[model samples]
Target: MAKRPQQSLHRPNDPAMLLLTSLASGPKHGYALLKDVEEFAGVTLSPGTLYGAITRLEELGLIEPLESVERRRPYRITTSGLTALREVTREMGRLAKISATRLRLSGEFA
Candidate 1:
């Protein structure tokens, strides 16, 4: 089957993109995704929130479950998910740069 395309922009600050981006590296289950996000981005997510995001992403065709040996299902990033990750990362970088410039000008953290 053909892979879905990446997204150009995230759905308005939705945190799911971060989860999808991390999964782009490989397949991971819901709990794994949560731990990875916390380790990589320092973002702690509740189980309910993570499941909700996963469900939404699955519905959107950005991600899907991969076959697994464990009870928990594993998920991988689809083509569309990769695109979304790229877009989200680019936008996040832009926002960070802008924040840094503003901070520097204000001598807040110089």
Candidate 2:
């Protein structure tokens, strides 16, 4: 059997991307992450969804947990995470430009 290709982690609406974007500003605990993402992205994430993405991001070495404070564990984006976020951001910008151009050509954008 041929080796399977790895799936990309970043998507426009991906929880992982949201988490990474939130952590880009600073370290945050789970609840803080939830609030920041909701405020900035207008997307609410359940505890299960947030932790699930956190696990995957940590496994990929994109984020790392900081010392727990009063039992709340905080996480910070690693250098690799910053790089990944930058790459994903650039890709999204390119896609957005294409989408805007197509929409304008179709008279769907003013």
- Tens digits of per-residue lDDT for model 2 on 31-100? 9999999999999999899999999889888899999999999999999888888888887878777888
Q: Which candidate is the best by TM-score?
A: 2
Give the alpha-carbon lDDT of every model.
0.75, 0.85
Ten contiguous residues minimizing lDDT sum, candidate 2: 1-10
TM-score attained by model 1 = 0.75
RMSD of 1: 5.1
Residue-wise C-alpha lDDT for candidate 1, range 16-88, written one tens digit per residue: 8667767888999988888888888788889887898888788878898888766889999888777777776
- What is the alpha-carbon lDDT for the whole of candidate 2? 0.85
Q: In model 1, which runs have C-alpha deviations exceeding 4 angstroms?
A: 1-14, 105-110
Could you estimate the TM-score for every candidate?
0.75, 0.87
Weakest lDDT window of 10 consecutive positions for candidate 1: 3-12
